[model samples]
Target: MLLKVALLFAMLIQIGAAIIAVSLIRRTRFNGSWILISGGFVLMAIRRLFDFSTLFGNAPVFQKEEVNSWLGIFISILIFVGLIYIREIFNLRDRIDELRKENESAVLSAVIQAEEKARQKFARDLHDGLGPVLSSIKMGLSAIDLQSLDQQNKLIVQRSTSATDQAIVSLKEISNQLSPHLLQNFGLTTAIESFEDQLLGNSDIRFQFEATIGGDRFSYQVEITLYRIVSELINNSLKHGRPTLIQLSLSQQTDMLCLTYNENGQGFEPDQLSEHQGMGLENIRSRVKSMKGIFQLESAPGKGIHVTIQVPAK
Candidate 1:
């Protein structure tokens, strides 16, 4: 009787644990290892139920000495198999996670490379094609002998020249925004400061930019990646948030570069990142992932927004 009670208690515990394991695996994302782990737990639970039945119930297999020996051996074999599977599940899960990250990183890198190539092509067209034509137009207008023309004609020419000048300026600015040469020549710090100046002039925002990395330059890819990231963050702040001040700081440690950005504006809930899917946010994250970097965001309504990024420099 005591043995039967113990067997029943063991069976109940195994069933409870199996249920919990199944519940967890069901709620989680599906994968082979998860299924295998869940199956192993379930097998252990069923084996316990069989043990209870063999000990308590009048089963013919338990009644015969030789048959009982074979039944115990079969049960032992299943228990060993289940344990082996459960043990291997850890290694399988880790391998799957590593492969997933590698796959994601490769996809993002390809997309970013394609984007950079397109930007380079567009910038070249603006700088080489439209830029020269606009400059010539400005020069031709200047060479026009306005004194020979009637007063009304001279006013028209002057206005046309002024509009042409503005157009040329806009073209240069837009081209630079696409891909800045300063980043490759001067370094990350100069490129970022120039961007801040542009944003400062175009909007009612104060930018405080600082860099402690000196004038040391990184590879063109890294420089451009960081530049685009910072530029986008500032653009988002200006476009979405009613902010007065935006602050950015950069520093470098051994093999790692860190950027910290803050905006004093109407911020959103931090949890929204998990609950909501925002393209702008996703773009930022994808860029960081391609750089093999870490991105973090902190925000709350009516308070402010803070972002910290760390990327490998080497």
Candidate 2:
């Protein structure tokens, strides 16, 4: 009795599965593969029903034994071919995904290159157009005869000359920022060290930068993206986090270049930040993604912040 019950249960399960496959034909738009698979399921369920009926002794046979054997073989062929078709569909989908990623990366690289070109143009305009104008003004002011002028007028001339000199200095600083000559001439490590040197005595924060690799050059995209990412992080810490110490390290392991940055600052809950907030973190993430790299950040309220970035060395 138990064997009969178990056989009936299995028949019901096979019948239900066949029903499911038939229903999916509509969703699959009657694709040939799904049609084949559905047919296979239906035949298998019919075979199960035949087996269940045999438990009752001398079960009715509507077809010859040879006919049933051929049907079973047909069902097996349908299922095998349908599964092969489904596997090919998955493979095609994966290929499409890879192409999409490559296209996105190419677009991102072009955009970054255009941005760098604009920066270079702007910097060149400032250096060539405005720089000499300020110098000419200072020279004209110096040529004035202070000896022939009254005391008050002499003082006015001196102040004007001093102000012109300061303006020239400020112009140079802005031009450098727009397009960093150091970064263009030197590699990543030297550029970072130079930036750290500029910030050394300006703030109370203790900044430490270490690079395990020296004078190693990478693709322009990799070096520039990393420099901008590091600069953004440091600026965020100074502007808001009030960190007393910031440490950064760069190293290369095998074919990967890794960067680690830490700040002992008043960190906040990362989850609390809205989509529009968080110190340009989304920008940083996009930059990392453009290079097919990884960006991981960790922080909590009062626990400080740490970040790790890894990209292909090539």
TM-score of every prediction relative to native: 0.77, 0.87
lDDT of each: 0.82, 0.86
lDDT of model 2 at residue 233?
85
Candidate number with greatest TM-score: 2
Clashing pairs in 2: none
lDDT: which candidate is best? Answer: 2
Q: In candidate 1, what are the lDDT values of residues 1-314, reduced to their tens digit?
A: 99888888988988898788778875766644555556656766776777776765677863555554655566566556656765787778899999999888889988999999999899999899999998999999999999999999999999999999899889888888888988877989998988788768787788888899999988887788889989888877776677999999999988999999999998888666442335667788899999889999998888778999998896
Clashing pairs in 1: none
Looking at model 1, residue 137 earns an lDDT score of: 92
For candidate 2, give the lDDT of residue 135.
95
- lDDT at position 16, candidate 1: 92
